[model samples]
Target: MIKIDAMMVCLDLSDIDEKLVAFSRTICERMQVGKVYFVHNIKLYELGDDFREMFGDVDLAQEVEGNINDIVDEQFANKTAYEVLVSEEPNTEVILADLVKRYNIKLTLLGKKMSTKSTGSLGTKLLRILPCSVLVFPETASFNIQKVLVPIDFSDTSVHALRLSKNLSDQLGLQLEIMHVYRLPSQFFPLISEEKAVRKAEEVVKGKFADLQKRHNEIAGIPYTLVRAANKSIAERISLHLEKGRHDLLVLGLKGNNPLPSLSLGSVPTEMYNTDINVPLWLVYSEEVIK
Candidate 1:
């Protein structure tokens, strides 16, 4: 029952990934969104003196809008209502943030190509500044919604994520899995043997998991698991879980324990973005649902 009225999709017209378009279309259909805004930002330098006159007196924005509409018609078959916007703003991030506010956008979709070196600073900034949720789709990601994995740490944000994931799973009839990864303190276990330390840590993790399950048993009526890794980073442990499990998507809660005044996402999600994991990611802000 999460109501998303409008969604903004950032597109790089010069390099359009078909997978990104397909995934966006699938989300639009599933969410039953009424309006989809396609936004593209261009540098001021790209506009030459003759460029405006070259298009038979058509403005630059109009020309770009026409092209975007054509692409949408051909690629997406015009499934949902859409608006095309082309901005000449030098800073794309600022323009995108402004559009999100102006349009009351509830979600933003960013496409990541496999060939790109990184998501770059723009992706990070958007995740931080945007008031709504953000979903990133890699070029190799599939549109299918099957099994979903959500990492939790018993925070309010984690509980909010679990609630949203449960709603989504119920709506889509998809399998949901909740996982918690714990790391044992190295210095505290120095007096005990490694085997005993590991056993104690497992017991502690199980106890915590059981407590969480009891608290949210109604929402998480599905299967859930707990993972314990002594030395591995949280991102590494999550990567290992994704490799072993058949999960197709990852739903994460942003601004969990480390709440930043400006940024919505925390260290764990930021690190996951930098990893080689190709699964599509859905990030839910704490304020979006926990309020």
Candidate 2:
């Protein structure tokens, strides 16, 4: 049984709203998460000198703590039991990682805008270092998991993501859709036509998918699709598919076929993270398998 004892939520006070809190609550209810930790890190420098001077004698930390409590009360009032942690750490990512370890967090939820401004550096770093899975919600996304899309590449990370997605689908009665995007070689000896190249790529993808199904027969009964396009980036193809399929959630493995043990974030997943896809994305990282 997969046990998710606690969930950690990183809240940006600049954009605290009821919808974001509601989304977090919905996920907690769906995942049956017991305890929710709401964490916010304050950059002392960002607090203007005037503000600091005004509260110089007073404990600015306490004032920030009160503000966080008020926000929680306004948003999650009586909805769920949660604890708030306010830190003055300059590096919010470090603070978040420490909290995750301290709380043994199983999942980290983050709300981010679908704009270039939101680099998602904190979420990305946590996904790389933390043992827990990271769930990123685009500002416009709702906490819905009706139909899930998992892109696989036949690697251990992909397999781990597939397994987890299957488990979630089974538990939540969600429609699971598996897809594999392939690119044909740019130059072939005979210079095959585009149509023939596409056909060949489809055959290869189907064969690999079939082999995966055979390996995991128990969950292989679900529907899977093959996407083939020449000279197109995987992230671009994935974005197109998400737009067309209207999948509520995208489950992705954190690392690809990179042999480097220190390369925490895979290129594909990172690109997807940076993209402005307006769907909730679940980044799965298998610590045991990856290490």
Best by lDDT: 2
User: Which regions of candidate 2 deviate over 4 angstroms?
Assistant: 77-81, 256-262, 287-291
Tens-digit lDDT track of model 2 for 72-126: 7776654456898888888877778788878988788877775656667666676
lDDT of 2 at 16: 35
Q: What clash pairs does model 1 have?
A: none
Candidate that scores best on TM-score: 2
Model 1, span 1-291: residue lDDT tens? 666788988888755444555677888777768788888887857678887567555566676777777777767765688887888888888889889888988888887765465545677777777767888887667778799999988788877888889888888888999888877677865687878877887788778777877887765466777787657888888888987997899988887334663555777888787676778888887564423
Shift of residue 268 alpha carbon in model 2, Å = 1.1
User: lDDT of all the models against the reference?
Assistant: 0.77, 0.78
Q: Which ranges of candidate 1 are over 4 A from the true structure?
A: 46-58, 115-119, 256-264, 288-291
